[model samples]
Target: MAEFLANYLPAWLAYMVAGAIHVGLIINLVAVGALVFIWLERKISGRIQDRLGPTRVGGKFGWLQTLADGLKLLTKEDLVPGGADKMLFRIAPYVSFCASIAAFLAIPFAGGDYPFIVQHVNTGVFFVLAVLGLEVFGVILAGYASASKWSLFGAMREAAQVVSYEVPLGLCAVVPVMLAGSLDLVVIGDVQQGWFTNWLIFHDPATFLIFWVYFTCATASVNRAPFDLAEAESELVAGFHTEYSGLRWSFFFMAEYGSMFSVSLLASILFLGGWNGPLPITEWLGLTAANGDIAWYIGQVLGVINVIGKAVAGVCVMMWIRWTLPRLRIDQVMATCLKYCTPLAAAFFLGAVAWQWSLPGRTFFGLLESPAELQSVSEGWSDATAAATDEDEPEASEDQTVSSEPSRKVAAAKLTGAAALQIASTNLQGGK
Candidate 1:
C-alpha cells in the first residue's frame, strides 16, 4: 500500500491540482475580462455620447460597476413567468454559458513548444467553430420558453441571424486555416513566426479583406448592436431574454460578453500572429534556456501578454463600432452578410489563391519568408540526412521487422498526424 501510494499518489495529486488551477484560471479570465470590458464599454460609450457613464462606484473609472451590477442581480428575486416552460427557461442561461466556456477548451492562451491551451486538439479549428454554433441553441430555447410573443420573435430572429452569418464566418475563418496549413492552432501560430506581415491577415489581399468580413460576421454572430435586430429595443423590447431577470439575466450578458471575447480571440489567432508579436522579443532577448526550462516560462508570459493585447484591442474596436454605427435593419443585416460579406470573402479567397500561385517562394511584402517553403526545405533537409544515415546501416528484412498491435497503433497515430499535416500543406498551397 505504501509503495503504491508513493508511486502513484504524487503524479495523480499533481494532475488534480493542475486541473483545478487551469479551471480556476480560465473562469477568472472569463469573469474578470467580462467585468473589465463592460466597464470599458460604458466608459467608451459615454464618451461617444458626450456623457458620464459610471462615476462614483469604483473611483475614477467606476471599475466596480460590474461588481455592483453582479451583486444587484444576485440579490434580486429570480422570477418565472406563469406560462413559461419552467425547466427550459431555468436551464437556458447555463446552456449558453456552457457553450461559450467550452470553446475555450482548445484555445491556446499562450503558444510555444508547450502551449498554454486547456486541450490541444488536432481538430481544434472545427471543434471551436462547431461548439460556438451551439450557443444559438440556448437562445432559441430561451425564446421558446419565455411564453411571450416578443421573446419568441426575438429568439427566432437571433437564431436565423446566427445561422446565416455563421456561413460567411466559417468561410472567412477557413481562409486563415488555409493560409496556416494546420488545424492545430499551435502549429498555425508557429508558422506565423517573425514579422506581422507573416500573419494570415496579411498573407494576401484576399485574406486581408476576409479578416474584416470575419470580424463583421463574428460581431453579428455574437449579436452585437448594429446587427442586433434580435434585441432591437423599439421593435422587440428586450428580445429573447425579455423574461429573464436578476442572476439569470446577468448570466446571458456574461455569456454574450464571453462569446464576444472568444470570437475576438479566435480572430486574433486566425488573422493576427496569435501569441506571437511582430517583434520576436522572446527570441531576440534570449529568454529561452538551453534546457528549455527558463525560456518556456518567459515564452508563456510573453505569449499571454501578446494574445491578451490583441484580444483587448479587438474588444475596443467592437465597442467603438457599436457606439459609432447605427443599427441595421434585419433585412439589411441579412443582405450585408449574404449579399456582401460572403461573396466578397469568397472572391478574396480566390484572389489570394491566385496571388499565391503567381508568386511562389516569395514573401507577401518582401519582409518575411514563406512559411510553407521554409518548413518544406527544413524537413526535406532533415529527412535527407536521416535517410543517408540509415542507408549506411544494414536494412532489416521485412520478415524480421514484424509490427505488434501497439506498434501498429503508434504507426497509425503517426500516419494520421502526417495526413493532417499533408492536408494542411495542400490547403496552404490552395490558399496561396
Candidate 2:
C-alpha cells in the first residue's frame, strides 16, 4: 500500500499513512474484541452458574451490555490517588494497551502470497511473546505510581508470576517451532497443511502434552482467573488498579482482553492447523491459483475464517476455564509453574527431540511415513548457514554438494547427543 501511494505522495508521508491505517485497524480490533469478550464472559459465567447473564441491553442476548458499561465508565470520574505520581499514572494504561496490541502486528490471520499481517516477522513467535510480556511493565508502573500498598503487592506478584511462567511458556512454544523447523509462523502453519492429524498437537505424544501446558502457562501469563493472583479483589482490594477508575481503568481491561486474544491466536497458529481447516475444504473446492486469482482469494478468505474460528474457540475455552476454576493463591501459582509446568515442558522437549531423532519418518496421525522433505536439525542449520552466507564465491558447487551429502548426513546424525556419540564410537571401531 505504501509503495502504491509513494507514486503520488512523499515517501515518508506514504509510509506514515499506511502505518496509521494499520494502527486504526488494530485499535478497532482491540476495542471490538474487548466488547465481545466481556459480553461473552458474562454470558458464559451466567450459563455456568445457571442464570441469565445480560438479556436487556441489546435484545435477547444483551450484546450491548458491554457497550453500555463502556459509556458508564466514560461518564465516571477519572480518579488518581492524591499521593500518586501524576505522569506515570496517566500513561501506564496506554503503555499496557500499546504493548498488548503491538503483538498483533506479527500474528498472521491468513498466509500464502497475500498474508493478513501488518508485519511478517521472521521470528514471529518470539516477537509476539516478547511484546506481550511487556504488558507486565505497564502493570508494574501503574502499581508503583499509584502509591498504594495493595497495588504494589499486586504488582510484585505479577512480576514474579509472569517471569516464572515465561520459562515454561517459551519451552512449550519452542516444541512446535522445532517440529515445523522454522520460527516464521507462516512456514510453521504451512508445514501442518493436509489433514487435521497433521496439526502439531498430534505430531507426537510430547507435542500433545506440551500444548496443554502451553495453554495453562498462557492463561497464567495473561493474568486470567484461576491464576489471577495479581488482581485478587477479595484479598488485595482490586489489586494493581486499586486507585484507577473511569475510562482510564477501562484501558487496563482492554489490554487484558486483547492479550487474551493474542495468546489464543498464537496458540491456534502454533498447535492447531492454523488457517488450514480439518478437511482441506478450500483445496477440495478447487480454490487454487490453477483456477484463477478469484479462486485463490476465496481460499485465503476461507483460511482467514478457519484461523479466526479457532482463535475465538480458544478464547471461549479460556472464558470457560476462568469461570469454572477457583483462583489459586500466589504460592500455588508459583509452584504450578516451577514444580510442574517447567519440568514437564523440559521433559516433553527432550522427548520431542529424542522422538524426532529416532523416528523422523513416523507419525501417529496417519501411522504413516513422513514426507522426504522432513530435514534433520543439522540439515536445517546447514540450510540456514547457506542462506546466511554472502561469500565472494559460492560455498559449494553442485558436484561437491552431491558428493558430500552422505557424509554430511552421517555427521548431522552424530550431532544429536550421547546416543549419537556412542554410535559414532561404535562406527569408528568397526571402520578401524
List the global CA lDDT of all models: 0.76, 0.81
Pairs of residues at least 3 apart in sequence or in different chains that clash in candidate 1: 288-295, 356-432
- The 10-residue segment of model 2 with minimum total lDDT is 395-404
Mind giving the per-residue lDDT tens digits that candidate 1 earns over 323-362?
Answer: 9999997667767866787678667766765654455334
* Best lDDT among the predictions, by candidate number: 2
Question: For all candidates, what are the clash counts?
Answer: 2, 0
Please write out the lDDT profile of model 2 over residues 133-211, one tens digit for every residue. Answer: 8999999999999999889878877877776777778778877777766677887787677777778888788989999
TM for candidate 1 is 0.83
Candidate 2: C-alpha lDDT: 0.81
- In model 1, where do residues sit more than 4 Å from their true spots? 1-15, 289-292, 372-432
Give the per-residue Cα lDDT of candidate 2 at 79. Answer: 88
Q: Show the colliding residue pairs in model 2.
A: none
lDDT of 1 at 162: 80
